[model samples]
Target: MGLACAVAWLAALTVYDVRQRRLPNALTLPGAVIVLITAALAGRGAAALLGAVALGALYLVMHLTAPSAMGAGDVKLAIGVGALTGAFGVDAWVLATVAAPLLTAAWGIVGFRARGGGATGRIAVPHGPSMCVATVAAVAVVVI
Candidate 1:
């Protein structure tokens, strides 16, 4: 059930981010709640849910320090990833951190080239979708 939710969330994020370049808080915020509730029922609430929320909050603080680099939506979405992957331990975090941006960067390159454009500051690819892909990939690596 958890994996299914994660997959669906990733798919939604990908479509939303690609088309809108924004990850709605409406989606991410409720997701964090669901994960938290599930983690609590699983007896891993503190570590999985609270910990993830802390991580998300920390990311927000970091973003505040460097708004030019990260966006608020990414910070909120990080909480969702943390909630989902937190159950698996630090490895989940590590995998997600590494994979999401890498995938996003790679995709951005191809996406831009396909549109007959080059990378520039004006073109900002949403990080949420990349994070979503990375989250799924991370889960797959951890599970199998």
Candidate 2:
């Protein structure tokens, strides 16, 4: 049940981010609540809560230091991702955290090269998709 909810949540966020380049609070806030509730029900509440706070704080710091690089929405979404992966274990959370940035950077590089290599401003590559992909991959690692 938790896994299903995580996948569905990721799917919805991915679609929204791809289309709008933003993850609205409407989805993220409620999603965080749901992830927490599910984790609690699954007997991993403590770890999930810890994961949410730790990862959220980490992202908050990143956002504060570099607003252009990490958006507010991404920080909110990280709470849910952390909660979900943290339910599995610290290893899962760490894997997802490590994977997301690497995946995002790789994708950004591809996108940059594709755009003719002549831009001075930030390329609006959506981080939500990369986050979702990393979360799913982390979950797979834990499950399998």
Instruction: Give the best candidate by TM-score.
Output: 2
Query: Which whole-number lDDT from 0 to 100 does residue 111 have in model 1?
Result: 75
lDDT of 2 at 105: 94
What tens digits encode model 2's per-residue C-alpha lDDT throughout 30-98? Answer: 998898998898899999999999899999999999998899999999999988889989889999999
What overall lDDT goes with each candidate model? 0.79, 0.91
Give the TM-score comparing model 2 with the true structure, all chains together: 0.95
Which residue pairs show backbone clashes in model 2? none
Lowest-sum lDDT 10-residue window in model 2: 115-124
Model 1 agreement with the true structure over 1-144: per-residue lDDT tens digits: 877976897788779877987778888888878877887888878778755876698778878998866788889888988877776667876788777778878877787787778446235667887888878887788888
**Model 1 error, position 36 (Å):** 1.2
Tell me the spans in candidate 2 whose CA falls farther than 4 Å from its real position.
Answer: 120-122
